[model samples]
Target: MRRIRVAAAQMGPIQKAETREQVVARMIALMDDAAGKGADFIVYPELALTTFFPRWYHADRAEADHWFEAQMPGPQTQPLFDRAREHGMAMSFGYAELTPDGHHFNTSILVDKSGAIIGKYRKIHLPGHDEYDEERAFQHLEKRYFEPGDLGFPVWRMLGGIFGMCICNDRRWPETYRVMGLQGVEMVVLGFNTPSVNSQKGEEGIEQRMFHHRLSLQAGAYQNATWVVAVAKAGSEDGHHLMGGTMIVDPDGFIVAQLGHEDDGVLVHDCDLDATRFGKETIFDFARHRRIAHYGLITGRVGAEPPPEE
Candidate 1:
């Protein structure tokens, strides 16, 4: 198996009170730590720049996108790229993208060792209710704030390996990984800002939080035979507590690296890209096992009307 070293940069959120410049500095520090630890690439969690703002309802769209970065490699974040270039480190990070085309998305950017933008992934799975639910504990206004990702699942070759990115909720879906797996992706880098409690579902505290986190990543890794590096903006920020437990899974689904406390930290792992080849050629071989011909309904349209009365 060909090897590639990686670091999962796990940290808690920047409270709504904090500024973007301060958060970007924090991210740079994490990149330095990962590079200091001999890692070739570092992965940071979603919305790493600001507090999880979608929890509270906002009437103005501009205010909602205030935390979103209008452009990549723009002001306040160029330092991260420059530092990565100087240190010969590559990084993957998730952020709220305020696209110039007039859409906002929870997106991830892949940067190579030379600080080149290799790829960008817009989150496809958007969670939370469209309107505020008063009975719930906390509000999740992601659907209210962001448009669903327009870009379908994509895999990119960079930093000496093939990689893919998906935000937190997207990990819950199997097709998220299957699509990239079909492309022979060797690794997947993803981030999340998941709260420790689920307000909308009306369940016990913390029951499904960790379960969904680990289960999704594990199954994705095992089923697709790819390395999964999932970092989280964990710990209690503001009044709410976000789940911590940042982790990395190997090609065979083993939890190779994990962070316990969720405070700003890094988990370094030696990942072998070649390890995935064995699985792709054997158990999960798409060329030999995928029966696309039988799954017609996947492409079939389930019309609500009776075929226009034909």
Candidate 2:
């Protein structure tokens, strides 16, 4: 029974006025709580350190440089590494990354119990448009701010199991999980900063949005036969609300533990890596069931094509 006690650390929100120092302090407080709860691993939400800045647009894209972290542990974030080392807890979190060569990506990292970064995944499925559109209720300039991830969905062996990482919109795509699932992933940890309402459709409120969130995670978990720990940076951010449904899903896609409110909190559960074996060896055994030849369209084409009129 290879078991890992994981904690879904759901954050309340980070206002634009909040400094990295203040945000790190909040993360540390959650770490303290998780450690006390006997959690050996902790997952924090996407854009964990800052308010989701892509919501705002800058005429000069360079003006948003202040929001990007040129280095993962650059001064303000080093304490998180130190605390993880102190608690000997493996952790994962997301942030906006600015490369030295001037590339930007929405990224997440996985650290081992020793506080060493073992793997990194840039978000491939970036949502929203690059150009500002009056049609949107609010701007989501992710395409303009960050390039799509160059690093593919890579998995790493850690904590006695194979683990994978994805961020926000990446979770909404099946390919994100399937790629790692092919690598025999036993666990997938992800973070999200999702708006409570659809920016384009006013009728699509929190209820529908939350339903999709659960549908994505649950389906991904069950189909892949892996445990999924999803954390959220929730509540109101500068008057724009982000939904919180931080949860831990089992191999059968059942949510074993979930956060109740859109607030700073942690949900811990013992996830036995062995739980994945049954489904993986049976129902979801890709080697025995998947027919790749018939799936060419998934990768062969990008946009949909319709049949010609008779």
Candidate 3:
């Protein structure tokens, strides 16, 4: 069976004021760390370029623009590409994207060892409020600031295997993995910035939130029989606490590598992509087990729980 080495880079808070150069430098350092350990691929947290700005109350367009990156290989982040190319390593990082047509999105990019941009995935699941709710302590205005991800979940041929990507909230949905699984994806990369508490519920939310995080990843990996590499940009940012549980899950629903803290850290795992076959053939074999019909949830149109009536 063949294997691939992967690194899940867990990083602490990044100040919104931090320049692109600073963020890129941080990413390069992680890349170097992974490369030194002979990792073939590195995965960084969602919005790895800047602080979690969706938490703040912002009315100014300019300020919002300041926090968004216009072009990926543009001036500020070119060094990241140059460095990865020089090291002959592949990487995936998440960021806020300002599209050429004036659309703003939460997005992630995949770069090959040659530094060529292989694929881009816009986050599909936009969480939080569309309108300001001053009653809450903090804001999760992702829906208010950014447009819903236009590009549906997609899989690509990369790094000698089938690859796919998803953002924080997207990873929570089973369909996110199913989309890629249909393509016979061998590996999935995801980045997250999950908060420590649910704004409405409070501390009881912690266990459930953390459970959902691991649950989705584990279930997704096991169901799809694909390697799951999940990284986090965790810790307190803007006076709000966040959760950090970076982990690498094998196709068999087992955690191969994990990091406990929400800080600057790297967890490396020697992944056998071929190991996916063991689960795929035995447990998650779609051709042998998946029932496409009789499950009314998938093809339903309204997405509103099917009217609650049989």
Candidate 4:
């Protein structure tokens, strides 16, 4: 039995005024807690170091560049790597990436037990509009701030299991998992910063939003026959609330462990990678069940084309 003690570290909101140093301190605290709980693998939420700045719009996009990380383990984040190495823990987390070439992406990385980054994933399914819209209750300018990920869904072998990474909105799309699932990924780790209420429709409150959140993760895990660790950066970020529903879902889509609130906390669980074999070899065996011929429309078209109105 290949068992990985995983920790989902859910962080509270980081207000705009908080520095990366302050945030890293908080993350270290959570990491310490996970270590105490005997967790060798921990996951932190998306944009784990800063406020959800995309909620505000800027006439000059470059003004937001300060929020992007030019280097992964650059000064401020080095401590995280050091602590992971000290504890022999593998870690995954999300942040905004600014490449030296000037490309920006919503990115996540997988660090091995020795603190070496083994894999990186840029979020592909970027949600929200590029331009500021008067209709939105709040701005979500992800498209304006980041380029659609050029790197496709990729998987790696680690911790005696196949691992994959995705970020925030990428988790909402089935394609994100299937692509890695095709590679026989045994586990998928992700981080998200989701608003508690729908910016488009306030009536769609936390209940509905959380429902969709769990629905997406659960479906992705069960369908792919993989374990899923979803961490959230949630709470009132300068008055705008983010729903923190950090959880660990098993291969059967059951939530084995979940954070009870939107606060700085850790939920640790022992995930058996072998638990995935039954479903994968039987019901979800893509090699035997996937019919690609009929899926042309999935890749061939950008938008859904309705069959003749009949």
Best by lDDT: 2
- lDDT of each candidate versus the true structure: 0.87, 0.95, 0.87, 0.94
lDDT (tens digit, per residue) of candidate 3 on 1-310: 6767888888898876777889888888888998899888889999999899888766764467778888888898899899888888888999999988888999999989999988999998899987779877678989877888888878888777889999999988998999899889999999999888888666656678888888999999999999999999988776778898899999988888899777788899988888888877877788888888866667575456445756
Pairs clashing within candidate 1: 2-274
lDDT of 4 by residue, 1-310 (tens): 9999999999999999999999999999999999999998999999998999898899999999999999989999999999999999999999999999999999999999999999999989989998999999999999999999998999999999999999999889999999999999999999999998888998999999999999999999999999999999999999999998899999999999898888899999999999999999999988899899999988999997788976
lDDT of 3: 0.87
Superposed Cα deviation of residue 36, candidate 4 (Å): 0.7
Question: Once all C-alphas are superposed, what RMSD does model 2 give against the true structure?
Answer: 0.7
**lDDT for position 267 in model 1:** 91
What TM value does model 2 have? 0.99
Residue-by-residue lDDT tens digits, candidate 1, 48-109: 87788888887676778678898889888899899999989889898888877879888899
Q: Model 4 segments beyond 4 Å from truth?
A: none
Q: How many clashes in each candidate?
A: 1, 0, 0, 0
- Clashing residue pairs, candidate 4? none
